[model samples]
Target: MENGILARRRRELITGAVVLAALAVLPLPIADVYTRNLIIITLLFAGLAQAWNILGGYCGQISLGHALYFGAGAYVATLLFVNAGFPPLIGMFVGGAVGGLLALLVGWPCFRLSGHYYAIATVVVGEIGYLLFLNWDYVGGATGVYVPFKGDSWLALQFKTQKLPYHYVTLAFAAAAWFAAWLIEGSRWGFAWRAVRDDVVAARSLGVRVFASKMAAAAISGFFTGLGGAIFAQYVGYIDPESVLGGQFSILIALPAVLGGVGTLWGPVVGAAVLMPVSELSRSYLGGSGRGFDLMLYGALIVVVALARPQGLVSLLGRRRERARAA
Candidate 1:
């Protein structure tokens, strides 16, 4: 039995390594902009979702206003770059710090609420940020801010030649976020988060610092989400209130982890991969077929997936693996 377990683990490791290797070089032959852009977008969402998973999935803090942090990262970095000539590559930290700061401000008060109330509070905070930025002309208001394209500078993380560099950069961010999630999933903090997630009252009784756990998770989540925003703004060379700081952005960020398998390391990544393609394809092919047809398709998919597998699509595969081991 021990030998079999070890062999299975080794095989799985090898297979995972092989898949990653293939993906690392996937862009060598592809030259089409659409396909490359799709890959980059998928990776972008994956990183954002994974960051969100730290709080939402692990700590059970269902925030509907996560875009607050994401937009902060983008706007702050862009502002620093445009005004101070700080360069976005360096200002990314400022963006992350701002995100953590916002989380600190909100999580303290909002953590007092439970379930839907907490979620609603987050949405309100996000809306406030959105409206404030929409009116504040310093950051370009509703017109949005654009990163000055001063030729190609690696220090600024600007690449002018092709989308290939972006593909790898986004992949790096996704991979790094995934690795962080993996580490946190197995750490002492991870256990505390899981405890708090399962039952706050019960966890407190067991000497768990419920508030601290949730707050830590939220701060970390915001920090990474903010980093993603910085990368996104820099990559797109644009940032606007409606585009980055909206409720839709929050929904897309949080939904992927839940749809994949909340509390699991790769849940958000899997969810992003599945959700993005479906959404894009639906919007592309079904847009002219009927008004709101793409949204209808997306809704149908979420409902079907939720009803068919409440534990998520990952659970289905997990069960198969369990059966294989049993056999």
Candidate 2:
């Protein structure tokens, strides 16, 4: 069993490396700005979903208020850049730290609840955060913060004419998130989280530190989620309560993971790959009709996917692998 586990880990690492290498070159052939931008959004959400999965999937804590952390990261990084003259490269890390810290703080109280109650608490917390940011004049209030164009510099993560750099940047962020999940999936904490997720009573009886596991998961999830938000703020060159901290943003973050097979390694990446394109295409083509046709189309796709693959699209890959091994 030990050797088998080690082999599986090695294989997963090799597979991840190959996939990253392919993604590195995948965008080079596409010159269309819209297509590249779509890819960037997909990559960003892929990372965010994976980050959420660390807590929601493995730890079985379904949080609906992740936008609080997401917006926190965005606001923190933007504030540092605009007010303190800090490079976003540095500010993003600070934002990630704030996100992780905030997650721990939130989890301290909210973790006392379980199941749907915990999820509801997250939504309430997220709403409170949105309201606070919306009224806080220091964070630019509802007017939002416009990230100034400080010339095209990698240090600042600003690119005026090129979209390829953003693509790679998001890709790297997604890769880092995926890699972190991979590490946790193989670690002692990963097993403990899975135990806690599977059954709290059983996990406790078996000596798992359920509360600590949940808190650790929350911190890690919030950290990457915050990092993703900072990347998004920099990418769009703007940040606002509605844009970053809205209720809808939290749903968007969790949907990919839930639809893609919450507990699996490649679920978020696969879900993001499918979900984001369909969403972008619908918005681009149907949004102009002004009747919410784009939203209808997006919802239809989600319904179909949920109905057809309740175990997530990643299950298809798992099925194929099982078949190959059986043969």
Please tell me which predicted candidate would have the highest lDDT against the true structure.
2
lDDT of 2 by residue, 201-263 (tens): 999999999999999999999999999999999999999999999999999999899889998
Which number leads on TM-score? 2
| TM-score (C-alpha) between model 2 and the true structure | 0.98
Off by over 4 Å in 1: 1-19
Q: lDDT tens string, model 1, 14-109? A: 654665577689977888888788888888888889999999888889999999999999999889988998988779878988998899899999
- What TM-score, computed on C-alpha atoms, does each candidate reach? 0.93, 0.98
For candidate 2, which ten residues in a row score worst on lDDT? 297-306
Clashing pairs in 2: none
State the TM-score for model 1: 0.93
